[model samples]
Structure formats: C-alpha cells, structure tokens
Target: MADFTTVVSDAHFLEAPRWHEGRIWFSDFYGLGVSSANEDGSDLRVEAEVPGQPSGLGWLPDGRLLVVSMTDRRVLRREPDGTLVTHGDLSKHAAGPINDMSVDARGRAYVGNFGFDLMGGAPIEPTSLHRVDPDGTVTEVADGLWFPNGSAITPDGVLLVGETFGNRISAFDLTDDGRLTNHRVWASFGPLPTDRSVEVVLPALAVAPDGACLDAEGGFWIADATGSRLLRVVEGGTITDEIETGTPVYACALGGADGRTLYACAAPDFHAEPRKAATEARLLATRVAVPAA
Candidate 1:
C-alpha cells in the first residue's frame, strides 16, 4: 500500500533499470556508470563505469554487461572478472550520441541515438535506430525517428521502442531467429505532454509489459521527464493510472525480489544551456503491481 506519494529520492540520474541476479541494475547518465541495489534501494554499488556517459544498459545472455557509451558512440562490456572491454564502436553509424537500448533474450541489442545534435544549436532532425550483433557489427534497423530512446523486447519476442520527442511507442515483430520483421504502431501518448508546448515533449522512457514481475498486468510505466509524473499504460495502450511527483521523471524499471517495486531516474535537462542539474533530479521508488514478463 505504499502510494506514489512516498518518493525515494537521489538515485543519481538513473536509467534503464533491469532486474537481474537478485539486484536492480541501471545507469546514471551524467555520473557516467552503472550501478545496482536491492529492491529497497539498499546497498547501492557502482557495478561499472564507462569513460563517456553511459546511457542504455543490459546484460548478455551469459550475464556480461552491455552499456551504451554516449559521447564515444560505443557499446562496452564488463567481463566476469570486472574488466571493461570495448564491445563495439558505432561512431560511423550513430548520427549523434547513442541513447537507450534493449537486449533480446538471444543477446542482440537494439540501440537508439539522438539523430541530431538537438543541444548543439542547430535545426532538429529525427534520429535512427540500429541493431548491434554480439560480435560488434552494426546495421541500421530504422530511421526518421525523433529522439529514439527507451526500448524493450516482449516475452513473445516483439520489439518495443519509445520515441521521446514523438510521444508514442512502436512495436516491431521479431522473427523466430531474433530479427526485426514487421513494423507498426504499438501506442501513442496523444494525451501526454499535458502541456504540449514545444519544450515539454522531451522525456526519457523505459517500457515493460504487464503481468511483469514488477508490473503484474499488461501496461507500460512511463517516466514523464518534463511532466513530473509516472504513468501506467494498459495492454492496448491506455493510461490506467498516474503517479505525480515534484521532479520531472525520466526513465523507469521494475526490480526487487518479487518485482513489484518500481525505480525511476529523475533528472533536469543535461542539454540545457547553463547546464545545471535539477536539485529535484534524483531516483524515486514505489511499490506497484507486478510487472509483465
């Protein structure tokens, strides 16, 4: 019965939370590393640090970590013995900084990027998405996307991606062998950006299906980075409920032994001029329905 009003603060700009090996692993974009903690946010530890800002995070099927190094446009891995190795360099394909990613059960990772230097005082453009193989080869999967961000793979092997700037989610059917096939609209956040100004559409996202160990129903939990809310989406993609907060919520994940606890990364605009981290930018948590697998 812990309501959303109970805020768990100061998670250091966390993103891409995943429940693995009895711990909640995630990234701190500005902090430039990955860390984890118990479901209760206890025993927080820095699992690994990338030289550039680390955004997306996931584990290989064998349990090695795959991280997105934003500034360097590379995918890095942490070996079993805690050694960091370059898994792949994507500088040639990524238009700007690589952002979030989702690794399939088969170990293939779908990586997204900024597409354009939105913070570089230039005209905005849509970003692109890529499929990165285990051996470090990069292939352009999709293009003409506005700030492609959070992504996830369904238990049935569908690929779900969130377009932060577009305020919608898309799903791509995965082949039996793990290749992306059919592409279609999954859901749209038409009612989001309640403010809907030119500047309010920039929120980071992390999506999970319902009946999940963390969200035991069919819906997506979205961190409304600029909206200051964590909203839940039903199977057909409807906002069933919403948790309001003072901080602009960024990305989210479900963790904890039972997978009912939700962790959110909150942060101010890292691309903002004067570049001040919002004091309200911190991690928050709450107990919720079990997550979908």
Candidate 2:
C-alpha cells in the first residue's frame, strides 16, 4: 500500500492524465471534457470540452493542445484562439472509439482504439493503431493489437503501447515518416490469453493496463484498471513496485514542481451508466521517488 490523498473528487470518470505546464491535465470520460488542476488538486478548471467525450491528451510543438474525442474517433486540436478544430479524423481507420494516444515531439500522434463495442459487451476485436500527422493525414501504423489503451513515447523515440486486455506492453520503433515498425513484446505479464471473448480476456487478465506515464527513471507507471493498483515497470516486464489504490485506478501521471507526484484517476467502477450517473470518480495523488520526464 502507498500513501495517497484525494485531490479532486467531483469528476464523473477521469482518464488519460498528463502533467504539463505546471498542472495535471486529465480527461473526464463521462464529463465530456478535459480539465487541469494544481499540484494538490486545487484550482480545478475546465480546460476544454468535447461532445464525443475526451480521452487522450498531448501538446504540439507550437503549444497547441491535442485531445482525443473517443466516440467520434477524432483528434481535436485547440488553437491559440481557444477554438476546437478537427486535427484528424480517425473513424475511417479505427475500428472503434479511440482511447489513448502518444504524441511525438514532431507532432505526430499515435492513437489506439477500443476495437470493439465495450459498453455493449461485444466481443473484443483486434484493432490497428493509427498515426495521425499534424496535417490530419491518417495511416495505419500497426494492426492486430488487442484493445490498445494507453501509450507513452520514450525520449529515444520508442513507442510503448499498453494492451489493456492483452496484459502486455508492446513496443515499436518510430520512423522519420511517423510510421511505427519493428514490433516487439516489450513486456508480457503472463501468456497470450487463450480466450478471445472480451468477457474472458478481461477476467483472465492479472493486470489490465489502462493509462500510463513515463518517469525520469526511463520506466513506466501504469494504472491497473481491474487490479486496483499502479505498477512501476522496467524493461522485461519486471514489476519494480506497486501502489495499491483502494479503488480501480484507470489512469496515472507523474508530475509536480519536482515531478515526483503520482496522480491517479480512480472510481468504484468504470461502467458507463453508473459512473456517469454518480460523481464517485476522483483524482488521487501520492509522492513517488521517480520523477516525470
């Protein structure tokens, strides 16, 4: 167990946390918007709103903010004038709602999708991860990913994607053209799930990777959606440490003035109807030794 304090408790459901510009920015999945707050979770403010519900978040080289509109499968960019415009339309290439994204320094966004009807309890489907250029050009970077959820990019340009249902993190090398290649299993908790059904795959998972954040130690802190914990993982899938948050942790970020604060988005459940109906979601924080990049 780790010491944690509640920073914000008024959200419906939060995901995709990013530490930037001296604040913790996150997407309220059911709240249909993006928000930011101070280090201790004070001074909460609505940064932007998306009708389709926002998920991932990133900033371009020009300081423009990019937000993922999940249901609509699009990336919305916030201009300098506070306008929300379509940066990329991923619906054509994505099989389902886009969930999370990792943006490169050059403004290329690699995005993942649910790959199936989650709320509808449809069977889980393998999907492709799309690379969206700053000019709104979309292309399939990799295919046959199992429920790709959260992602992070290393300073060395390796792309690490968390497969929520696959219980593993997949790695890819980024090309100059913003394409992903040379796929390898960066980390595998156990084995490839024999069951193909979402119901079975979900239950069989030991650690359902949700959102992720890179630390200064060149490792990742991952939110375990079903495990009620956060794991600090190094290369080769070694679980270095674990932070046990009593509730289900959907996302995490390492940020603060010193970059040691670990922020988690937690809730009693992630069900669509229940989480949206009640404001049980919260932003929780704890201090860690590893700082954010």
Candidate 3:
C-alpha cells in the first residue's frame, strides 16, 4: 500500500498544485480560488479568487503568481497588492476551456485547453498548447495534443506535458523565446481510444495522466485521474515507481521542507456540478525517497 495522509479537506475539487517558496499552492477547481498553506496544511490562506475557476498555478521569477482561469480561457496575475488582473486572453487561440499550464523560469506560460465541451458531453477532439508571454501576448506554439492536462519543466528547460485522453505524455524543447518545438512522446500508457465520444473516451483511459511535477532524480510525478495513483516516470516512457492514492487524483506537486513531500489533489469525481455542490475534494500528501526538482 502507498502512504497517504490528508493535508486538508472540504475542498471543491482541488487541482494544479505547486510547491513554492515554502508552501503548497493550489487551485480549487470549483471553489473559484487559489490557496496556499504550510507544509502540514497549517496557515491555509486564500490568495486569489478566479471567478471563472482556477486550474493551474505558477510563479514568475519576480515572485508574482500566474493562475489559469479555466472557463474564460484567460491567464490571471496576482499583483503584490492582491489584485487579480488579466495576464493574457487565450480564447482566440483555444477552441475550448484552457486547463493546465507550465510557466517557465522567465515567466512565459504554456497553456492547454479541452478543445471540446468536456462537461457538456461534446465529442472528444484534439487540442493545441498556447504560449502566453509575460507581457500577455498569446501564440499557438504546438498543436495536435490530446487534452493536455498537466505539465512540468526539466532542469535543462525541456517541457513535459501530460495528455490525459491521449494516454501519453508529450515532451518539447523550450525555445529561448518561450516557444515549444521538437515534440515527441515522452511516455505512453495505453492506446488512444477509437471512439471519440465522451462516453467512451471518459472510461477508456487506462492511465489518464493529469497533473505532474518534477523531481531531482530527473523523473516526473504524475497524478493518474483514472488509475487512482501517483506515478513516477523516468525518461523513455518508463514508470519507475507508483503510490496508490486510493482515490481519483487529478493533480500533484513535489514539495515540502526537504523537497520529498508529494502533494495530490483528489476528489470522488471530476464532474463540476457534483464537486461544486459538495466539498468532498481534498489535498493529500505522502513522503517519497527522491528529492524534488
């Protein structure tokens, strides 16, 4: 059995967890906010309210926080005075609601979208990843992703994006100006479903990679939404280790005082109405042997 402990509870579908400075920062998917807390979930504080619902969270080198406002297809920045302002408008570049994002050390953010009305039971469709500059210019840098959900940047500046519906993790080389190129399969867990309907694709995923974080061991710690586990994968599509969370884990982050703490965002289901009506989602944590990146 995998070690698991609840850091907090009664959340409205938590996702997009990040370990920043000395706290765990995360987005409450249906709660419409972003929050942070100490290592053990103490001193929990709401840092920003994203009316459209928050998905991913990242920080610029200058310490400003960048958060994804999912439904609106926009990125918001939290100013030092706590004001939330538009960082970029991605509606023009995205066909559906934007999901996970990875902001580089230079503050450039790479975001993904659903490419279809996921909650409305629309047919599953392919999507692209967009890069939002620090100054709020938007550009479609990579296309043909299958519901890109989570992402992380390697020490050498490579990007690993988890494609939930594709049953694979895609990798890219980050250009000096914040664009992605040289796309390749970083990992694959199963075959892509033949049926594109949401009914079939929803249950067909075997690995359903969602959110991810990097470790000092040069591996990825991924949340498997359908597999109910946190997977650690190395280069060449190899799963090095895994921790069964016993619940649907939608996102994860590796951070703690010593950088060995693995944080997971879990809930009973991903449906917005059910999660929004009841606060059953939680933030969970476990200790790992590898140091974080």
**Candidate 3 all-Cα RMSD:** 0.9
Tens-place lDDT per residue, model 2, 190-251, is 67777768767777898888999899888888999889999999879999989899889999
In order of appearance, the predictions have TM-scores of: 0.85, 0.98, 0.98
Q: Which stretches of candidate 3 lie over 4 Å from their true place?
A: none
Q: Rate the local accuracy (lDDT) of all candidates.
A: 0.70, 0.90, 0.90
Task: Give stretches of model 2 more than 4 Å off.
Answer: none
lDDT of 3 by residue, 1-293 (tens): 57788998999899999888899999998889899999999999999998999998888889999999989899999899999999999978899999999898888999999999999989888989998898999999998888998999898989999999999999999989887889999898888777889788868787898999999989998998888899999888899898988888999999999999999999999998999899999999999999898
Question: Model 2: how large is the Cα RMSD against the reference?
Answer: 0.9
C-alpha displacement of 18 in model 2, angstroms? 0.7
lDDT of 1: 0.70
Candidate 1, residues 206-249, lDDT tens digits: the string is: 33221111154556677665576677765566778777766656
Off by over 4 Å in 1: 1-12, 191-216, 268-280
